[model samples]
Target: MKGYLKAHTHFFLPSEQMAEYLDLPEKTSYSALPPAGDSNQVLPLPDSALTLFYVGGIGAHYKLNAFIDAARSIPQIRVNLVTRKKQWDEAIASYPTFQSPQIHPYHLNANELDDLYAQSHIGVLAVEPSDYRRFAVPLKLFEYLSRGRPILVTEGTEAARIVSSFNAGWVVPYTAEAIAATLRRLQGNRAEVQAKAANAVSAAKVNTWADRARTVADTLTGKSK
Candidate 1:
């Protein structure tokens, strides 16, 4: 560890805040895994009710309850909660409407997300506030954007910046009421959702994995393209 630290001249981190916290050196850059997805992976499902999905980590800090309560409140809106089976089961049981067929929970399978995303209209990015979290972006954010799904992110996440920049989705308060309200809005105004989905795919084109790789390679080789 000691020798490696000295031998390494540059550092590439995912989060700027993380790089600062480490305080390694001035020779630092950020390289997040920008996985670009094909919009064709998910086509509009011919469903009357608007569907939403959350695919990633799940726990208390994730504030998944807000998603649950919000989706539960709007019975017309459907949800797909994909996460680890144990954590998903444990967390979901805390809700009274855990048995609702409208709100489906799945044992996460990274390779099998296309169909799930295909059936959804929006992706939820719900995380509670924290010093570090405020400046850290989530990979799921990129996933949602890449797959042409508008997101429903909390008010204060750093990921919200990207959503705002691309006009990719709505950023609401981290509360069931707020999320429910937004879902209601989208349900009645699906054209708005379609517009945002288009924006998401446009954003994905500029921030794809190929883009990340080329940028990193160019930076490392001191080459200007």
Candidate 2:
């Protein structure tokens, strides 16, 4: 397979073992889109309530229930979840934490989701720890960075590593306690939050879809070493 294929492309690495086994020429890329908002836009430190935004599928693997529970415990923190009605219903039924007033669930279109990202203070991605998650980078992570939102991602995922490397957000255990504690810390340190948000914007500049495309093109064309 390696001999026949010119190159092996991946949205993100599959796994260390798989990469070693394939031993093929590899080009790694991210499924990032151009930022919806202005990358130069400076987000002021939150003086009021800190809002956490999440926009995507509400599958069980996302571990959104933990976020909801954390939000329920933190009255000062606001959570906005944009997803389908069916998923929302299931989540609310399964996790009573969704009943908390701090948790605001909405079904929105692309434009609305973008608007929500602009309004929110932080982005949350609490994926469950799994083999698939270890290497996969969720598209929402890039979108959050592009929109200049500091992220709160679960530890041990590719997204967490990227966020940490870029200093764009907090990476912690996938638990309600950890989420709530991080939110409290961020709420207390507005300056840190602002710094992380700024870092996220900077990361977006390099990780945008156009930049990633050019990198892939360069690799294929033998223009990149």
Worst 10 residues of 1 by lDDT: 33-42
lDDT of 2: 0.73
Candidate with maximal lDDT:
1
Error of 1 at 58 (Å): 2.2
TM-score list, all predictions: 0.85, 0.83
| Model 2: residue 184 alpha-carbon error in angstroms | 0.8
Task: lDDT for model 1, please.
Answer: 0.75
Q: Against the unseen true structure, what C-alpha lDDT does each candidate score?
A: 0.75, 0.73
Q: How much is the lDDT of residue 113 in candidate 2?
A: 76
Candidate 1 residue-wise lDDT at 57:
68
Model 2, residue pairs in steric clash: none
Q: After superposition, how far is residue 128 of candidate 1 from its true place, in Å?
A: 2.2
Per-candidate RMSD vs. true structure?
2.7, 4.1
lDDT tens string, model 1, 1-225? 346467774455565556666666565444444335544443553465798888876666676776677777886778888888877777757755655767787885788888888888888886665666666777888888877888888877677777898999999887889878988889999889999998888887787777877777886797833
